[model samples]
Target: MTQSKTWSQRFESALHPAIARFNASIGFDIELIEYDLTGSVAHAKMLAKTGIITPEEGDRLVEGLEQIRQEYREGKFVPGIDAEDVHFAVERRLTELVGDVGKKLHTARSRNDQVGTDTRLYLRDRICRIREKLRDFQGILLDLAESHIETLIPGYTHLQRAQPVSLAHHLLAYFEMAQRDWERLGEIYQRVNISPLGSGALAGTTFPIDRRYTAELLGFGGVYANSLDGVSDRDFAVEFLAAASLIMVHLSRLSEEMILWASEEFGFIRLTDSCATGSSIMPQKKNPDVPELVRGKTGRVFG
Candidate 1:
C-alpha cells in the first residue's frame, strides 16, 4: 500500500479503541463535515485573493475539498481517532485527496478558531431547528387549547385543586411560554451567526487575509472583531443550553400535568395506551410511564 493508504488503515485501526472508551464524536461532529469543507473553501479562496497562495493551488484545494465533501455525503468518508477533532479529520482527508495542496488549506487557521466557527455554525442551524420544534410544540398546545376551549379543568396550586379554569386557557399558557422560548432561540441565533474563522487560536491572524470575504462566503453576518473573544466565547452554546433548559422546564410542567391527569385519583385525563405502560404485577394498572419518564428526564436535562 502507498503511504497515504497505510496511514488511512492505521488511522482506522486506532479509531475503535479510543471511541469505545471516550464516546467518539465521529457520530456527532460528523455533522460539521459540510461546514468544515465550506470553511476550507473560503479560506483557500481568501488565501489566493490575498496572494498568500497561488490561485491555481487555491482552485485545486477548493476542488479537493468539494470532492471530500461529496465523499462524506456519499457515505465514503470515514473519520479516525488519530484525528483529534473534526477539523483535523477533514484536513487529513483533504490532504489524502490532493497531496501537498490539501495541507495548505489550514494556512492562517487554528483548530481553536476553526472549531469555534464550526460550533457557531452548528448552533445557528440547531437553534433554528429547535425553534421549529418549539413552534410545533406550541401548535400542539394551541390545537389542544382550541379543542378544549370551554372544557373546565381544575387548576392546581401546590398540587391541590385551587380553582376551575378553561382547559384552553391552561394550555394556552404553555403556548405563550413556548413562543417566548422560540423568540429566545431566534435572538440567540443572531448572536451565534458571527464568524470566528479569522481568529486563529486566541489571537487574530497576522495574515492579510480578508475576514469579511470569508465571512460572506460562509454566510456569516460578520467576522468577530476580538480574536480572544471569538475563540473563547462559548456564550452561544451557553445560550442554547439555557434555551434548552427552559424548554425542558416547560415540557416538564406539561408532563407533570399529564402524569397527574392520568392518575386514578385525578381521573381528569385518560392517556392513550401508546403513551402509557401496564404494570407487570398490577395487570389492571395502565401506568402513565411516558410522561413520568419525560418528567424524570427533565432533571437530567437541567443538570
Candidate 2:
C-alpha cells in the first residue's frame, strides 16, 4: 500500500530499511491516535478563530479528523510502520479524505509540540482512570478492614513477629498508601494540564496563533510559558513514572505479605481453589501464584 512521506524530498535517497525501522514510532505511538485527533481539532479551531485558516477549512479539517477517529474505532484505518508515527498516520489519512485542506492542519505547529500536546492529553485521561481505580481498591480495602476490626494478627518487623495487632489496622496501612498514590496523581495532573501546542519545534511560531485559545479548547489549564520548554520538557512523564513506581512498591509490599501469610509456616491466610494453582507432581501443593507474580513483576515499573 502507498503511504505519504512528509520529508520525501529532503533526503537525497530513500532511507535504509534498517534505519527506517529504527526511526519508526508507529508501533507504539498508535495508542496516541485518539489524543492526536483531539489535539488537531483544537488546533484547527484555534487557527480558524485567529484568522490563520478560514472557518470553512477549519470545519473541514475537524470533520475529516472525526471521520478518521471513527475509522480507527471500526478497525478500518490501521497505520503500519510506513506511516512513521501517529501524527503522520492521521495526517496522511486526513489528506486522503479532505484533499489539500488537510495540509493546513499543521499550520504554526511542529511535530515536537504536537506530540507533547497529545502525550499530555493522553496522560491526563489515564491519570483520571488510575485515580478512579485507586479509589475502588481503597473502598475494597475499607470493607475488608471494617469486617476484621477486632481480629488479631501478629505484627512483624524485619519479617519477625513483634506484637499482636488488629487486622483492620494492618489493612488500613495499605489503604493509606493507596490514598497517597491518588493524591500524587492529582498533583501530576496539574502539571500535565498545560498545553504545549504552537511551540513550533523549539521556538515560538511567527504566525499570530492563539495558544491560550487552543489550550481552552483542549480543556488545558494554560499554555507553557516558554516555547523551548514546551516542546522539550518531559518532566511530567518522568514524574508520573516515579509516582507509578511508588504505587507499585506499595502493591508489591502487600503482595509480599500475602505470600508470606499464605505459607504453611505462617497460616495467616488461606488461598481459595479458584485463586491458587496446583503443582503437577505435588498433590498437596496450592501455590499463591497471583501474589507471587505480582511481587516478581513489581520491578518492571520502577523508574
Candidate 3:
C-alpha cells in the first residue's frame, strides 16, 4: 500500500525511495511524541488567549491533541514512516480528530521552534531523573562508607601498594565525584528550561502572540531573547555530553578499582555469586564480568 505523504504539495515529484528512507526520522523521533503534544497544547492555548484563534477553536484543538495522547498511552496511536517526524505525526493525527480547527494550532509557530521546544522539554525531564539517580547512588555510597569506616585496605600508587587507608575514605572519593555531577546537571537544567516556541523558523512570528505566556504555561523559566539563538542553540546538549563524559570517567575509574580488588592477586574484595559469572572452561573461575563490562563501555559515553 502507498503511504500518505505529508509534504507532497511543496514538491513536484515523489521522493526517491532512498531519499525518503534517509529523510524519515520517525524510527527514533517517535520518542518525542508526548513532548510534541504537550508543546502543541500550550501553543493552542496561547493562540486562544491572544485572539489568533477563537477560544472554542483552541478548545477543540486541545481536546483533539489530548485524545491523541490518550490513544498513544493505550497503544493505539501508531505513526508510520509517512509522518516523517513526531511533530508532523501529531499534526496529522490532530487534523483527523478535529478537522480544520486542528490545522489552526500551528498558526504562530514553525517546526523549527516546535522541535526545539520539544527537545528542551524532553531533556529537562531526563536531567531531573538523572539527578535523582545520582542522589540515590550517593546515598548508597554513604551507607557503604559508614559500614566500612573501620575496614583497612592497601592504598596503591602506580598499581603498587604504598600505604594503609580506610575503605570508607576510598568510597567517599566517588561520592565527591557524584556530587559534582549532580551539581552539573542542576546547572544544565536551567539552560534547558527556556522556551523557544514563539521563535518561528529562525525569526520571530508576525502573529501577536504572547511568548512569555506560553513559556509560563509550559513551566519554563523564560522566553529566548533572540529568536535565531532560541531555535538554533544546542550548547545545552553539548554541555550535557561533557558532564556525562565526566560521570562515565568516574564510573570507569571505580569499576577498575572493583575489578582489581576482586582479583586473587589483590584479595581485597570478593565477587559475589549473583554479581559474577563462571568461566566456560575453568571449573573454579568466577569472572568479574559486571565491572569489566562497565569499564569497557565507558569509552562509548566519552565518544
Could you say which candidate leads in TM-score? 2
Model 3, range 4-82, lDDT digits (tens) per residue?
A: 4566787666766666667899999999989999999999999999999999999999999999999999999999887
Candidate 3 runs further than 4 Å off:
1-5
Residue range with the least summed lDDT across 10 consecutive positions in model 2:
1-10
Cα lDDT tens digits for candidate 1, 16-133: 5534436446656878988777878888999999999999999999998899888888988888754545776887888887898888888898888888877887888788788888
Decide which is better by lDDT, 1 or 2: 2
Residue-wise C-alpha lDDT for candidate 2, range 76-139, written one tens digit per residue: 9999887888899999899999999999999999989999999999999999999999999999
- Supply every candidate's count of residue pairs whose N, Cα or C atoms clash at under 3 angstroms: 0, 0, 0
Query: Where is model 2 more than 4 Å wrong at Cα?
Result: 1-5
- Give per-model TM-scores: 0.87, 0.96, 0.95
By how many angstroms RMSD does model 2 differ from the true structure?
A: 1.8
**True lDDT of residue 65, candidate 1:** 89
The collision pairs in model 3 are none
lDDT of 2 at 233: 77
Top lDDT: which candidate number?
Answer: 2
Q: When superposed on Cα atoms, how far off is each prediction in RMSD? A: 4.5, 1.8, 1.6
Worst 10 residues of 1 by lDDT: 1-10
